[model samples]
Target: MLERLIESLEAAPMVQRGDYHYFIHPITDGVPLLDPALLRDVACAMVTVMDLHGVDKIVTAEAMGIHIGTALSLMTDIPLNILRKRSYSLPGEIAVHQSTGYSTGQLYLNGIEKGDRVVVIDDVISTGGTLKAVLAALENAGAEIVDVCVVIQRGEPELGRAYTPLVTIDVDADGVRVIDTCR
Candidate 1:
């Protein structure tokens, strides 16, 4: 099933490469449009796997990770929580947490509870800084992470033994490259 999805994604003319073994596809010609159908398909695929593995909730970073995390939540009928890299004036004590996103920076999450089973989601995985911090937060919050879902996975350092990654691209080396046809 994943093989077919990989073939479909590879054949799609819209898919393009980015930094850190990442790839993005424009559903429309411009404006960073996201296709609901594609998102649903990806989410369903992830849920199928998660169901087999038994995951309870979906966790992810703020901003773009929300897209994949929402779809997964819907498909799995699970709650979604986000690990925020930025504080949006959310009512809380403003605790100090650190993380590295696909880029370098500190990250945070508010309102996460203890002992929740979670699956992290993201649009892509590059350097794994963000993922590492997210896992740390989940541990701090006392959530048991089962896995991670992503649209693309670039070659970078692993996020320790926390979880496994599910992504469109499995970067085998140190750099992000657009597949032959993506260019």
Candidate 2:
């Protein structure tokens, strides 16, 4: 179903950072030109599995997750809330600290209200740091998380709640190998 994403992942360049094999791809890195077809495919896959009914908003981290969330929002006609790296000092803004495998930063979340049903989407989930922070912030804001999903999964990192990943892969110096494809 996601042939293009599969092929692109396989062809992605892998860089070794210490013992980690980081694959640079459009979906996560925003390099090599993000194909619209791939984004659409991912959004389609998410809709098939994620329960969007009664969802009041679509939420995602800034930067990488924006495009993926945008595609999903556009397709679903749901409002999107982007968590930012910098705080705007907005009245209801909530700051969340996140530590990823490579970087650590505080993400600012705003606009989600109590009892609002939300669906969280991201480009990839490697260490689950960003998603974890996002989920925590959302829950703290009293938002009801309807579902969570990512376009790509690179080895599992424990996020408190279960999330659907369109594709699962194993990376090494050789390249990215597809371990599982959802959908």
Candidate 3:
């Protein structure tokens, strides 16, 4: 199953940005050119391997992570909480500083409270900075992070926590390559 997904991604349209290469796929970039079925297959594969039992909520960042998180929440019958880029002047809302490989900004947290057991899901893990900040915010909120999952991991940046990524991508002067897989 993972092999098919890998093949599909390998054949995806890639856009080079300076020294980085980005795969414009439905799962990651949500390129409308690709069929939605591809994203479903990737999400289903991730759900199959991840142990969501005992988790109280599914948490994810805004944008790309929303689709995967929604799917997981529906399948597991758990509530989904998304960290938004915009701030909401609401009670119990918390904000955290996030720095990723590509960009840095503030992420707001809501819909999750103390004592909640959550699994953080995302589309990609590159520098691990975003996940690190998110973990800190979740911990500060008194939420126990059960696990972390990423659909694609671009590089190793020491997240200080264990994470399961469907595929690990390595890019350099040689271009993108699937160096590792979680299947």
Top-TM-score candidate index = 2
Per-residue lDDT tens digits for candidate 2, residues 19-91, read 8888999999999899899888888889999999999999999999999888888998999999998999999
Candidate 1 lDDT by residue in tens digits, 78-122: 788776667776754133344444345656677666766777877
Total clashes, candidate 1? 2
Q: Identify the runs in model 2 with alpha carbons over 4 angstroms from their true place.
A: none
Q: Relative to the unseen true structure, what is the C-alpha lDDT of residue 98 in candidate 1, on a scale of 0 to 100?
A: 42
Residue runs of model 1 more than 4 Å from their true location after superposition: 1-23, 26-31, 51-56, 88-102, 167-183
Which of candidates 2 and 3 reaches a greater lDDT? 2
What does the lDDT read for residue 142 in candidate 1? 79
Tell me how candidate 2 scores on lDDT: 0.92
**How high is the CA lDDT of each candidate model?**
0.58, 0.92, 0.82
Total backbone collisions for each predicted model: 2, 0, 0
**Candidate 3 — which pairs collide?**
none
Q: Sort the predicted structures by lDDT, highest score first.
A: 2, 3, 1
lDDT of 1 at 111: 66
Say what the RMSD of model 3 is.
1.7
